[model samples]
Structure formats: structure tokens, C-alpha cells
Target: MPSSINPGATLVLTGVTHILVGLTHPRLGPPLLSMVRSGLFDSITGISLDPTSSGAPQYDRMAAWWFELAGAAMILLGISIRENINVAGYVPRGVAWGTLGVGVIGALVQPLSGCWTLIAQGIWMVGWFGKTKME
Candidate 1:
């Protein structure tokens, strides 16, 4: 087993993961989608983008749910391997990377929606990097 792991790190990792999951998968609706749709809000929030025109909101919702699952997995991994040479650090890193990847892909296929999600993910990734430390 790895040493030098602390409860604080585990808590932080879990908290961050929960935040990501919440952001991606709210109980009512995807705030990210709503935020992406409102032009005024997006611009004011510095996340300007157009609303989704695709007739597949359910597909998007399902995708978000899967992403949340992935985030949960990362959280568990971080907690389980908290002292494994900074593997825990990658949980947020993976979240950021995954978000960025999705954003990029979204941008390529759907510029407005993609860019909006990218902005949100970018902000989250920035926070993740700033808040966490490698062990």
C-alpha cells in the first residue's frame, strides 16, 4: 500500500469530482446546456455559444451521465491510490483533459455548443490545476 496519503487529499479529490459530476449532471437539467443556450448569460459569463440544434437532447443527457460516471470513477481511483506517486493528481487532470477533449470535438462538429462547453471545461480545468498539489 502507498503511504503519505492524507484524508484531506482524498476529500479534496472527492469534492472536486462531485463538483464536476454536479456540473455535468444536475438532478433537474444540465446547467451546462442552459448556460450554453442563454446568449446574455454566456457572454456575461464569458462562455458565448449557440444553443444545440440537434434533435437529440436525450442523447446529450445520456452522454453527460456517462461522463459523470467517469468522473466518479476518477474520484474512487484517487481515493484508492492517493499515495501512488501522484496518481491521484491525474483524477482532476483526467477530468480537465477529458473536458477539453470533448470541447474540442464539439467545437469541430458544432462550433457554438462546442466552444461553450469548452469554456466551461477550461474554467474548471484551470481551477483544478490551481487547487491541487501532486504528492
Candidate 2:
């Protein structure tokens, strides 16, 4: 079946995908990793505690990884909404809520990194809100 979609929604989805791809890919990855390593970002954001000698967070890394994955998922979710509203139905409202939840958790844990994810999820949430179902 032809996708029941809107042009503006498609633009939003494509824009979000481009942003997520840029953030996650290798070109931007090292700079981001360097920021995390150097503590400059944390210093500016004021969210980090002292790390042990191993140079890792005292807490679990899973939440940070989850936030990144959620950002990627939001890109996919936007694509699905653009290409197929039926696929949108498969995603469930909970995914958006879950994304927002992760964003909040990530922000609390690592403000700088988390804020980017939060913005992505927030954009996706806006796209979702703007979408309309066509019979």
C-alpha cells in the first residue's frame, strides 16, 4: 500500500535522521569522545563526579549506551512515520515515552551527552505530535 504521509512530516523525519547520523558516526564520534575523556564537557555542564583510576564512571555505563541507542531508534521511528504510518502503529506511544524517560535519566547522569539525546527525542516527539493518520 502507498504510504499515508505528509510532506512536512517527511521533512522532519529526514532532518532528524541526518542529525542522528551525524552525531553517531565516526566523524563526530572522536570529538565527542574526546570531550568525555578530557572532562571539559562535564566541567562546563557540571555533572561529573570523580572517576576511579580506571577512568570510567563509578556507575553503570548501560544508561549512557541506552540513551545513544534511543537516539538511533528515534531516527528510525521518524523514518517509519514518514514511509508508513502503519509502521508508526507498530512503534507504540510507549517508545516516545521511553525515549523521553531515557533522555531524562541520561540528563541526570550525564548532562551534556544526555542533552543532545533529549533534543533528538524532543524533536521526534514533536514530529509524532504533528503526524496525522489517514484512512
Candidate 3:
């Protein structure tokens, strides 16, 4: 309960960045565009990616898929949190703390990743500057 926090914007921006990364990925971008062009009209059922596959192409697809999915999830989470804050006037402490813990653990494992953003969001949520009203 310290002060200023704008978690929504942070999460959204991070998500957008991740999505862009996935879209621009050299190996995955072409296939992604092809899928989009096809309108995903074709059935994509029963498609299983073998995690054990060691081929460079298989790994690239896996990485790209996970990246895009995570980005989408972040966007969804941000929108949901924003809506909740709009209605409740505050983010739950559990959410803030949870994000902080996640950030810390993720950053520990991958110091160069976006976990830093999560860390900042958590810090802001818990207490950083001043509490601002959601616009």
C-alpha cells in the first residue's frame, strides 16, 4: 500500500513487445503469415509438436509457438487486471505479491528477459511512488 501503480499499461506494453518479437522471428514469421493468409480456415486439429524433437526447425516452431501464446496470455491478463482495477480501485495484494515472486524467480533464471518488467509492475503495485486513479 505504498503508492503509484499502473500495472495495466506495463503488462500491456510487455505483451505487445513479446507479440512483436514472435511476429518478427525469422524462422516463424513466414509460416505465421502463411497461416494468417489462409485465415486459419484449415483444420489445425490433432497437431502435436514433439518436444523431444531435436531438429532445428522443430525447435524453432516450438519456441515461436510458446512465445506467441505467452504474449497472448499476457495481453489477456493485462486487460483483465485493468478491468478489475477499474471496478475495484485497487489490485489485490496477492496478485501483486505473486507477480513479484514470479519476477524474482524468472529473473534469477534469465536475467536478460522481460521478468524485469514484471518486477517493476510488482514493485509499483505493492508500493513505489503514489497511488494514481485509473484513467
Candidate 4:
């Protein structure tokens, strides 16, 4: 048990960040793949289109889809956790920890884009009052 933990803010910020990342992937990830996928939206994102042309873009798209859903799920789960805990109930600590783990893994995987999540989730995890906070 930690001395101080503002589960509310933690859940809200982390949840929103995850949701935004997931939502943006679908909205923005496709254009970068236009040359590889063959479609309307066309542009360059600075990342070499070479890999996408190498047949790995298919898998890349699939992974992005997974991350999108994961983000949505995080939002829902975070809300549920906040609600359950605030009202006073048996919201298992494991649930929070597990969510944090998943979030951190995703953040670590894409530190460049997920930097916000990385820092936010890290704070949420430490379970500190002013700075870090985790379970």
C-alpha cells in the first residue's frame, strides 16, 4: 500500500492518452502506407517507405490495429476502475497493476510516439503523491 495515490487523475490521464494514441493510429497511420497499400491518401512521414514496400507493411498495419483496440480497451478499463474505486468497492489492485504493465509495455515499445504515455504511466505506476504513483 502506498502512502498517497490519486487514482482518479492517474486513471483519467493515462486513459485519455491511450485512447488518443489508439484513435490517431487509424486516422493518421494509413497515409504513410499509401505507396505500399495502393490507395488515395498519399504522403510521406519521413519513415522509409522501403520497409512497407518490402511486404512488412501488412504486418505493420495489423499491429497498428491491435494497438488501436488496446487503447480503446484501456479507456474503458480505466473508467471502470475509477468508478469502482471511487464509489467504494472491490476493485482488485491486480487490475490496476496489470493495466499499468500493459501500458508501460506499449509505451516502451514506442518511446518516440508514446513518450507522453511513458512519462504519465510511469508516474501513475510509482503511486507517489506529488510525482510518481503506482501500485
lDDT (0 to 1) per candidate: 0.48, 0.51, 0.70, 0.52
Kindly state the number of residue pairs that clash in model 3.
4
Over 1-135, each residue of candidate 4 has an lDDT whose tens digit, in order, gives 333234544555665776566556665466335534655243223345466553223455555555656666656765665565445433455665665576577667876665455346545544522232234
Best by TM-score: 3
Model 4 Cα shift for residue 85 (angstroms): 1.2
C-alpha-based local distance difference test score of model 4: 0.52
Looking at model 2, the pairs that clash are none
lDDT of 1 by residue, 5-78 (tens): 44324434654655565574555246446535655231123222546433434444455545556556645644
Clash pairs, model 4 backbone = 124-133, 125-133, 125-134, 126-133, 126-134, 127-133, 127-134, 128-132, 128-133
Best first by lDDT, ranked: 3, 4, 2, 1
Off by over 4 Å in 2: 1-74, 81-91, 114-132
TM-score of 3: 0.69
Give Cα distance to truth, residue 71, candidate 4, Å.
Answer: 1.5
lDDT of 3 by residue, 1-135 (tens): 322335765787789998998899787676667666657564133344866644344454455667788888878877766665666656677877887888899999999988888898888767622345445
Better of 3 and 4 by lDDT: 3
Candidate 2 residues 49-117, lDDT tens each? 544333444222333334455555656665654555554433346655665676677678888653554
